[model samples]
Target chain A: MKILVDTLGADKGYEEIVKGALKALENHNNLYLTFIGNEEEIKKLVKNNTDKINYIDTNEYIKNDEEPALAIRRNKKSSLHLGLKALNEKEYDGLISCGSTGALLAGATLITKRLQNISRAALTIVFPTEKNPCVLLDAGANMDCPPELLVQFALMGSVYSKGVLNTNNPKVGLLSVGTEEGKGDKLRKDTYELLKNSDLNFQGNVEARDLLSGNSDVIITDGFSGNVLLKSTEGTAITIMGRLKKGILGSFKAKIGALLLKDVLKDVKNMLDYNEYGAAPLLGVKKAVFKAHGSSNARAIETGIDAMVKFVENDIINKIEKELAKKEIEE
Target chain B: MKILVDTLGADKGYEEIVKGALKALENHNNLYLTFIGNEEEIKKLVKNNTDKINYIDTNEYIKNDEEPALAIRRNKKSSLHLGLKALNEKEYDGLISCGSTGALLAGATLITKRLQNISRAALTIVFPTEKNPCVLLDAGANMDCPPELLVQFALMGSVYSKGVLNTNNPKVGLLSVGTEEGKGDKLRKDTYELLKNSDLNFQGNVEARDLLSGNSDVIITDGFSGNVLLKSTEGTAITIMGRLKKGILGSFKAKIGALLLKDVLKDVKNMLDYNEYGAAPLLGVKKAVFKAHGSSNARAIETGIDAMVKFVENDIINKIEKELAKKEIEE
Candidate 1:
C-alpha cells in the first residue's frame, strides 16, 4: 500500500519523520511512502529506500498557530495541503501527518471530503485502558457538537473500534458527568436518547473517571470535552511520573530501590506511552487519514504508519459508509 | 467559630462523618460543630465531645441521583437542607457537607444564597500541583456558563486562591483547547476577550495539558469541562498507581524495591491525597460552605473542618462581595 507522509508541523523536525518512514519501509517490503516537505532532507534520510519512497519537496508548511481552513486554502504548496490533495486524487492509499490537528482535519474534510451520508468526520484517538485499548473521539475536531453530530461520532467511533481495533460488538458509551441516562449537559442528554435507540451496542453514560477502566470500547464525546479529557490524562501522567522521579532521587535508600526497580518503572512508563499507541485516525473522511502527535519521534511515526496500514487493510472508511447507509435506510 | 456539618450523602456512612467531626473537635478547642444527621447515631459517636458539638437529629437526606434544584426544594427536612438553612440564618459561621454536590450548590444558592453582587456561585476545588495548591472553579456547578459567568468564576477563583489557598496575586487562566487567544470553542473565545479586559491578573488561555504544571494559580472553565478535567486527572493518577503496583508485584526483585521505597511512595501518595486537601469550598455563596469528598475519611473531615475555619476567618465571602461590588461600580 502507498501512503502520503507530510513531514512538517511536527514539534520534532522533518528528519524524525523521514527516519520513521524509513523504519516503516524496512518493516514492510510492500509498503510505499511519498514524503512531502524539505525534499533535500527527506531524500538524504531515505537514501537507502529510494526505490520504495517518493518525495515532494516543499519548505512551505502550515503552522500550528495558523487558522486551519484559511491555512489550507492559502498554503496550497505546503506539505499538509499538498499531501491531502494527493490523497484526495487517489495517488496514495492513505495519508499520515504529524502536523497541526486542526489543519489536518480541515484539509482532509475540504480536500479529501467526507464519505457518503457522513456529515462530520471525527478525530479518533486509541489509547490503552486496563482491559484494552479503547477508542475516544471527536478528540478536538468538532468542538461545538450538536446532538446529531455526537450521534454521528458515536457511530463512526463504533465502526473504527470494530473494524480497526478488532473489538467484538464494540460497546459505545457517551462521556458524561455521571453514568445515568440524563447525566450530562443538553448535548449529552439528547445524544443519550438517540444512542439508546440506535442499533449499535449502546452502553449508558460513562463518567470521565471510568475512561481508562475499559467499561466501554468506544467512548464518544464532543471535541471540547474530549480534548480536555485527553490532555488532562496526559498532563496527570506526566505529573505523576515527574513526582516519582523526584521522590526516587531524593534519598540514598530510594536511589538503591530505583536502581532495582528500573525495569518495572520502564514497563509502567511504556504502558502509558503515547508512542506505542501511535496515530489517531480522522474517521468518516472518504480517504484514510491518521494524525500522529505533534511531538512524535521516529518510533511513534513508525507505529503511526503501521496503524494507518491497518486502517486501510480493514477498509474502515468503506465499512463506516456502509453502517451509516444501513442506519439511514432503517430509519 | 461555629460550623454546621451535614452527616449525610457521603458514600461512607454517617459513622465516618461523626468520627471525623470528633477528630476536628479534638483539634480545635474554640470551634463548635452542629452535626446534622441521625440524631441518635451522631450522639453515640460524639458522646465524648458533646460540649463542643450540637446535634440536629434527622435521618432524611438527598440522594446523589436526585435533581439538584428539585431535591433542595422538596427535601426541606433533609440534613443538607437544614444545615444550609441554619447557615443562611447566621446560626453558624459556615456549613460543611460530604453530600450531593448538586444539592449542596443548589441549596447554598437558594437557601444560603450567593454573596451580594455575585451572579453565580462556583464549586471550587483546591488541588496540589508542582508549585502550589491551585484553585479550579465551576468544577461542575454552572454547566452552561456564558462569557460573563466565566469572568465571574475567574474573579471568585482568584479570591479563593488568595484568601484560602494563600497565593498572592493569583494568575487566573481560562481553560481552553489551546493556549492561543482564539484557540477554543465560542465560549472560550468570548471568555478570553472579557478576561483580557478584566483586572484579575488574567493569564491567557491554558490548555488542559498545562493544568497540573503549575502554569496558573487559578484555572477556570465551565462546569462540564471542569468536571471532566477533574475526574480525568483523578482517573489517570489512579490508573498509573495501579499499573505501578501491578508491575512491582509481578517480580520478586521489584517487590524488594517496593519494600525499600515504601516510605517514598507513601509520601508521593500523600501529596496527591484528597484527604490531605480536605474539602472544596463552594465559592461565591454568602455563607461559608465547604463540600468534602463523598468518600471522606476521618482525616479528610478533620482537614476539611480546618479549611472551613480558615475560610471563615479569612472572610472569603465578604472579600468576594467587595471585589464584585467594586467591579460593578467601575463598570
Candidate 2:
C-alpha cells in the first residue's frame, strides 16, 4: 500500500519519521513512502535506508513562525503543499501528515478537493465512551458550515460508523446543547429536521454530556463546535486524571498503594488516552486521508500507518460508494 | 437582593423546586424570590413561608417531555418564560431558572431581549483553571453565529470576568481548534482578525486542551460550540471521578487510605466541580440572569441564588456599562 508521510510536522525531527518509515517498511515491505521535506534532513533521518523511503524535495518547510493559510498561499514548495499535491495527483493511496493539521486539512480540500456530492470533508474521531467508542465528526474540519453541510456530515459519519465501528445500524445524532427537538440554533434545527426523515438511524438530539453515555453511535456537528467539544473533553479528562495522580498519590502510603495498583493505573490511563485509536480519518475526501494529532508519539504514527494500510487493503471506497448509493435510494 | 427563581422544571417536579426555593429563602432571608409556577404546587412547598418567597403564577410550566422551543412557545404559563418576562419588566435584579437551559436561553433572547448596545447575549460558566477561575461564554447560547458575534462574545466575556471574577484586566481569547494564526476556518480567521483590534486583552487563539491550564482568563466562542465544550468537560470530569471512586478506591486498602485523604479528595473535587463557584450567568441581557443545571440539588440552587445576589449587590450592570464605555474609549 502506498502512503505519503509529511516528516516535518511531528515534535520529533525527520530522524524519527525516517525510523518510523523503516519500521513500517519492515512489516509491509511493499509499503511505499513519499517523504516530503528537505533532502539533507531526510537523508540524515533515513540514514542509508534510501531504498524504502522516497524523498520529495520541497525546498521550503512552512515554519511555525508563518501563518498557516498565508504560508500555504505563498510557499508553494512547502512540504505541506507538495505532500497534498502528490496525494491530489493520486501518487498515493492515502496521505498521512502529523504536521499543522489545519494546514494539512486546508491543503487537502483546496488541493485534492472533496468527494462527489460531499459538501465538505469532515475529520471524524472515535472517542472512548463508557459503552463503546463513538464517532464524532467535523471536529473542526470546516468551521462555518451550512445546515446542508451538517446533514452531509451526518450521512458521512453514519457511513463511517457502520463501516469502521461495525455497527449494523448506527444511530445518527445531531450534537446540540440539549437533547430536545428544537434545542440548537437555526442550523441545528434544520439539520435535526433533515436527519429525522433522511433514513439514517436518526436519534433525535444529543447533549455533550450524553457523549460518554452511549446514547448514540454517530454524533455530527459543524467542525468548529465539534473540535471545541472534542478538545474540551480531552482536557477535562486529563485534568481529572492529573488531579487523581497528584491528589491521591501525593502521600507516601497512598503513593505506595498506587504502586501496588500500578497495573490498574495503567488500565485507567489506557482508557483515557485517545492515541490508541490511531489518526482521525478525513472522511469525504476523494482518497482516504488520515491526520495524526500534533502531539502524537511514534506509536500513534505507527497505528495511523497500520490503520491506513488496512483501510487501503479493505477497499473501503467501495463501501463508501454503496452507503452513498443507499442514501440516494432513501432520498 | 431581589432574585427571580423559576419555581418549575426539573425531573423532581414543582415540589422539589419549591422545597429547594424554601431552602434558598431560608438560607438568605434578605433575598426575595419571585417563584413563578402553578400556585398550588408552589403553595404545597411554600406552606406558611411568606417572608421572602413570593409565588407568581404565570400559568406556564415548561415540560421536558416535548420539544423545548415549542414547549416554551405553547405554554405561556411556563415558569421559565414568565420568570424571564419578569426580569424583562425590570422586576428583579437577575433571574434564575432551573428549567431546560435551551428554553431559558431562547426565552431570554426572544422574550427578555438583549441590552440596547449588546447584539447577542451569551451564557457564561466559570471553570477553575490553573490560576483563577476561567470564564467561558456562550456555553450553548446559540449554535450558528458570525465571526462578529464571537468578537462580541469576547467583549462581553471580558466584562463578566472583570466584574464577576474580579480580574482587573482579564485576557480574552478566541476559542479555536488550534492556537496558530489562521489555524481554524472562516469564522475563526475573521474572529481572530477582529479580536486583534478589539478592546480586549486579546491573547491569540487558545486550543481546547490548554483551556483548563489558564491560557486565557476568558474563552469566548459561539454558543453551539461553547455549550458542547462545557458539557463534555463537565461530563468527562464527573464520569472519570465516578470511575475513580468506584474503580480506584474500590479495594479495601485504598478505601482505608482514601478516608485519610478525604481533604485532598474534597479539594480536588472542588477544583473539578466548577458549579460551586456559581450558576452560569446569561450575559448581554438588559437584566442579569443565571441558569443552573436542571438536576441541581439544594447546594447548587443556593449557589445560583448566591451568584444572582452577588450580581445584584455588586451593581454588575453598571459595572458592565462602565467597562464597555471605557473599552470604547480605549479601542
RMSD of each: 1.9, 4.0
> What TM value does chain B of candidate 1 have?
0.96
Cα RMSD for predicted model 1: 1.9
Give the distance in Å from residue A159's predicted Cα in candidate 1 to where it truly belongs: 1.0
True contacts kept of each: 0.81, 0.65
A148-185 per-residue lDDT for model 2 (tens digits): 88887777777777767777788888888777787788
Q: Which residue pairs in model 2 clash with each other?
A: A140-A223, B59-B77, B60-B77, B60-B78, B61-B78, B140-B227
Candidate 1 interface RMSD value: 1.3
Q: What would the per-residue lDDT of candidate 1 be over residues B301-321, giving only the tens digit for each residue? A: 999998888888888888888
What C-alpha lDDT do the candidate models reach, one value each? 0.87, 0.76
DockQ of 1: 0.75
Alpha-carbon lDDT of model 1: 0.87
Give the per-residue lDDT of model 1 (tens digit) for A1-331. 9999988888988888888888888888789989888877676666586788788889899888888899999998998888988986755799999998889889998899888877888899998888889999989988788898888888898888888778999999999888877777888898999999988799889989998898899999999999999999999998888888888988889989988888989987887889988899998888889999999999999999988888888888888888888988998
Query: In candidate 1 chain B, where is summed lDDT lowest over 10 consecutive residues?
Result: B41-50
